[model samples]
Target: MNLTEQVLHVLDNALSLQGRTAGFTRDTPLLGALPELDSMAVLALLTGLENHFGITFSDDDLRGTVFATVGSLSALVEQGLARQDP
Candidate 1:
């Protein structure tokens, strides 16, 4: 699957989102916009991404900008994969 689909899957499962994430688009608001996206959820998402993609996120890497939207999150994952490449 592509980054967006993979992220959507992770979000759906991690947050118990009940498949609601399928409606999300590139411009969809995150962070403060989604009530489900609380502090705990943010941490869970980071952990999920790290475990799923086999990458680690530093404190400086965990920023609101990376989780701004589905597109942004996918871009962050792509960047992480690039960094992991030999």
Candidate 2:
């Protein structure tokens, strides 16, 4: 899957959305908008993203702006992947 689709998949699984993410777009709000996205869920989402993308996130990388929207989260993933490039 592409990065966005992969992100949505990780998000859906992390939050237990049960496929509700099918309707989510890049603009979809996640941090404050989704009640399911609690603090624990954020940790789960980070783990899922790290495992899925084979990238790591430092504590400094954890920021509220990264979770603001689907697009922002995907961009973070993109950045992580970019950092892995040789």
Candidate 3:
């Protein structure tokens, strides 16, 4: 899967969305928009993304705006992938 699809997969798995993410798009709002995305879920999602991508996130890498939309999160993942490139 591509980065965006991978992100949606990680998010669906992390949040236990039961395939609800099938309709999600890059522009889809998360953070305050998704009822399933509470604080704990955020942690799970972060961990899931980190594990899946084999990239560690520093404190400075996180911000509320990063979770504002699926596109933003996908962009974060893209950056992480770029950082790990040889």
Candidate 4:
């Protein structure tokens, strides 16, 4: 799957959305918008992203804005992948 699809997958799986993510678009609000996205869920999503993408996020990279929207989160994943030296 591509980065956006991968990100949507992570959110869907982490939140147990049960394929409801099909309604989500790049503009979908995340942080404050999704009631399922609590602090624990946030951590889970971050860890899931790291595991799925094989990347690490520093404290500096964990800003809330990164999770503001589906697009932003996917961008972070893309950024993490881009930083990989390969």
Best model number under TM-score: 2
Q: Write the per-residue lDDT of candidate 3 for residues 8-74, one digit (tens) a residue.
A: 9999999999999999999999999999999999999999999999998888889999999999999
Residues 1-86, candidate 4, lDDT per residue (tens digit)?
77798899999999888998889899999989888999999999999999998999888878889989999999888888888967
Q: By TM-score, how accurate is candidate 2? A: 0.97
Task: Give candidate 2's whole-model lDDT.
Answer: 0.95
TM-score of each: 0.90, 0.97, 0.96, 0.94
The candidates, ranked best first by TM-score, are 2, 3, 4, 1
State the TM-score for model 1.
0.90
lDDT (Cα, 0-100) at 79 in candidate 2: 90
Clashes of each: 0, 0, 0, 0
Return whichever of 3 and 4 wins on TM-score.
3
Error of 4 at 7 (Å): 0.6
In model 2, the clashing pairs are none
Please list the Cα RMSD from the true structure of every candidate, rounded to 1 decimal place.
1.1, 0.6, 0.7, 1.0
The regions of model 3 sitting more than 4 angstroms off are none
lDDT of 4 at 38: 96
- The runs of at least 3 residues in candidate 2 whose Cα sits more than 4 Å from the true structure, single-residue gaps closed, are none
Distance from true location, Cα of 34 in model 4, Å: 0.8
- The lDDT values for all models are 0.84, 0.95, 0.95, 0.90
